[model samples]
Target: MKKYLLLSAFATLTLLSCNNEGTSVNNTVESMKTPAMENFDKAFKSLGDPQNRPTEEEKKRNTSELSDRRKALLVPASKELILSLGVTESELMRKTGGDMSQIIVWATQIYMKKSDEIRKNIKSEK
Candidate 1:
């Protein structure tokens, strides 16, 4: 009976330690957002707003085409997000020829790649 009690106590302690470690890892991952990640998240979420979403007519029209005015609305946010990712304005302009669509696309790709790296790091740590 003494041996049984000692074994039970050890098992309980081991399970508790494991649960705490998993919680700590989860909290660490949740708090690992960079400024660039936040900027990209905010920029993408802005598109979900009612005013930013395309209207039915717009959907029926050239759905892929963004009017200059619409592009202008997103340009500042896109620039901020891209710049946060360590690209200089001059380099961005040179690479994209000052095109808003190219800038947004490049920023999105960078954000996705960064996110992938973070996920891989978390998995490796686990």
Candidate 2:
């Protein structure tokens, strides 16, 4: 009787866990169809136009917030990292931080990849 009770309890927990996971899987599938990429492309193109380049004030702020030397060091490394992640030049630039677009891009890729990996693992388990 004790063995039967333990098995039933284990089965109950497993079913409840799967039930909760069903909602998350459904939500992820729904979100995958959202028009987020369109919005991102629109915003990215706007940021790339020459006439829309950062203003003098913005440059000054960036320079002050982040020294020129650090910015120079990060920019190329950031660009390479973003490229590796398949992000476009315009998209990478749009995610700038003070003067550190490269670092920002790298960090963004890291986070996004991490989230994707986690989601993949969850799906695999399911």
Q: How many backbone clashes does every candidate have? A: 0, 1
Report the poorest 10 consecutive residues by lDDT, candidate 2: 33-42
Query: Residue 1 deviation, candidate 1, in Å?
Result: 25
lDDT string for model 2 (7-73, tens) is 9999999999999988888677545532433233243455555755566767767654434443454
TM-score of candidate 1 versus the correct structure, residues matched by position: 0.67
Query: Candidate 1's residue-wise lDDT over 34-101, tens digit each?
Result: 77667667766777788888777777787577755567666776787778867898998999999988
Taken over the whole model, the C-alpha lDDT of each candidate is: 0.77, 0.58
Residue 20 of model 1, lDDT score: 100
Q: Number of the top candidate by lDDT?
A: 1
